[model samples]
Target: MTETNPTKVQLVQVDPELEGQRIDNFLRTFLKGVPKSLIYRVLRKGEVRVNKKRVKPDYKLQAHDEVRIPPVKVAEPQELPSVKLNKVANLEQYILFEDDQLIAINKPSGMAVHGGSGLSFGVIEALRALRPEQKFLELVHRLDRDTSGCLLVAKRRSALKSLHEQLREKQVDKRYHALVSGHWPASRNKVKAALRKNILKSGERMVSVAEDGKESETRYRVLQSFEQATLVEAFPVTGRTHQIRVHCQYAGHCIGGDDKYNDEVFNLAMQEKGLHRLFLHAYSLSFMHPKTGERQTLIAPLDPQLSQVLKNLSHA
Candidate 1:
């Protein structure tokens, strides 16, 4: 069934030139915020019809076609809870890349990507306050709350659209560094798997391979290895949610200090060794500039906690 804010409106006159136009395309010009996926859902459910007939997405609409639009039920915009700016004193320290159209930050552990689950504010809201005149600040991609480094933000709508297209086209290159809990078998390995999301009783997102799931891919090479763990560089080819963390676990090497996805006992052991935060960091991102049309690569250095984890783990 389709879930959306349905619009209840009387039939409007269609131009003569609009006759025989596809319903989906015609609706695009009139609607705002309803995703194309939702539109297809509406068509399939017969909420939108053409000339008293159940029309599919490809169905043509003639002039004066009486289209019945279901009552619009749009999701309301979430209000951002207030935050005390003084608490986030080091928020400025994370900025690593900035331009008129974009900005990249070395996002630290303990800061969320957005306000939810009782979080008062995320970095985006803080950044938005920093530049109120810009009118929009959008997250081009996401990094886990406890994972540090290289989070990209788009300053304008056009840049966000272009960069998102690049991601879909597989033109964006992303590389990460992670310290995992076991010695990998190969110097380099590729993990190709399908991942499905299942909600745990505790309300956290849990992922595993399922027959019906999204395809995820990761390529890794051992950079440093020790008695019980290894430091590796990971390159993700697809942007599925928690793609890297889930893939690492599927490979039998959960990332050190990953509380949500990693083994709990192993995580506690790492915590004893001063590895308190998630030992994963986005190291580099390369893409073509949206406005300049030039190739660009941005890098964010490892934070102290992750660096120390490597230092202490390599010797053990």
Candidate 2:
């Protein structure tokens, strides 16, 4: 088997017992989990060398030939497999901001924020595919897949570190707009509950308000009202998992189409009206520039479908 931590090639003194094997086969004996196809590709690209000279995969092994290998780095971001964009074609107009230091995308519902849970691609993957020259793009923070809003990404490592620090210090300001079921009793409210992680059947982590849960705080105010539902602006004081959703639920109002923690009947009604996902949008974000320390704010208007739903509900 190949070396477990092989970053680059190293010379080895040949033992008489293994002298006559084919060079490729001999090399494969030391490497584990590496496929022959990849080995061949590396060889064809002149990444493998014997005695300081590039050699064919079929080259014969010599007793003491010094093998050289170019250092192996993780596959470049641009070279990753493409993420098809057919599903999100309508949401393309939501890119609210982009710059050398940051990228802000208005993510839509039914799309994942990042690749995990057997998913093959996500918005970041597609972005990397579109911009091949950028060597790094790191997520500064995350919003739920069903939560539409301004998602931030840093273009460089230093920027990522700085942005994360800002988030920890509560220096970034985030606002979300959500349409929730039931009329709220109060126009302004604050929910101060702790959130505890719950495990779902699929082994995914969920959140619930519990007495012993981590501290979370969410402030909300009514924006508009329909007959049975209301739109509210929410500002979370602490970045706890599912803080807004749990706090809203505790307030006797739940965001529409929040399947994970919402009223099923209400969710179904919204689905019938073609509102199949959560009615939550990350409406605004403000933070100091990671490099220059200048204040910047990004905003994303609601997706057209959500806006249309609001209009229909208003007419009702």
Candidate 3:
């Protein structure tokens, strides 16, 4: 794990592995135990500087750029509890691809990506424990906690930078398999709506379609239709929080087993059919190798339980 000296103002030079990382994310790692709100506050107040100039939270750091961090008290690092190690060992079996620059895993549903918000450990934390020798592992992108599928992790900083560029330019192709309530209209192949994110009083996050929200788009192709549900492929053109699930709801077909944006009666029906989790899986991803520029595509087959649900629906 990376460590920073917090007892005094320190100037650290960015390395190749951290190139193109957002300054705010970089600070979070450098200043472990500091709250995210404080990190943003520091950025807003110009207390954190890059090359002696204040930069926004989204400013990407370049190699050799000097970052000045002010002195701040951080909590003492805690030792990893023993039970977490056992959970991490299970992830070894899900590795779909691994190379010098990156690793791709078929992340399981119900597992958060990185620990926070009461989760003691997530995929990234477990991976870190599993590979203590790795110095620069980081998440390239994210998947919803209940959505299982192909997930990318960068082994080097340069690779992370390259992949971020691809995502920003929409050069990478991601596809998901989803089971939703109701019969989807054959002609309704695309959904374009603006989404705005909100936080409830309890700090829970939600998203809804709004006129003053960010533009979001999802392309849907019905793979199969049943009396009460439809199996479809979802291609999200813009990545927003809960984009696919919310858009499907907007189409009057909320994803099955989605408690946040789903119909309760429909969920009960899907549960009776053996659906135990959200029926959204990131089935495939296509992108250029950040190191070689060679195109690579990875696929994660549906979990057997999810497959069984589809079979049950098809036969019904």
Regions more than 4 Å wrong, model 1: 1-84, 87-89
Residues 1-316 of candidate 3: C-alpha lDDT, one tens digit per residue: 4444467888999986677789999999888788899899989999999999999999999989999998876767755435346668889989999999999999999999998899987888888778889987889999999999999999988888899999999999999999999888889999999999999999999999999999999999999988889999999999999999999999999999999998999999999999999999999999999989999999999999999998888532
Tens digits of lDDT, candidate 1, 1-316: 3346544554656665466667897776455446788778888888776666788788877767777776655544444433446535466678998889899988888899787788878888777756658655889999888878888899865687789999999999999998888678775489999889888898888888776999888999888878778888999988787888988988889998887678787788788778888888899999999999999999999988777766776454
Pairs that collide in candidate 3 are 17-157
Worst 10 residues of 2 by lDDT: 73-82
What is the alpha-carbon lDDT for the whole of candidate 1?
0.80
Q: List the pairs of residues colliding in candidate 1.
A: 5-72, 5-73, 5-74, 6-71, 6-72, 6-73, 7-71, 7-72
Error of 1 at 279 (Å): 0.8
Q: List the residue pairs that clash in candidate 2.
A: 1-29, 1-30, 1-31, 2-30, 2-31
lDDT of each: 0.80, 0.77, 0.91
Residues 208-293 of candidate 2: C-alpha lDDT, one tens digit per residue: 98999998999888888787688899999999877898888888788898877798777777776667778999999999998789
Clashes per model (N, Cα, C within 3 A): 8, 5, 1
Candidate 1: minimum summed lDDT over ten consecutive residues — where? 75-84
Ranking by lDDT: 3, 1, 2
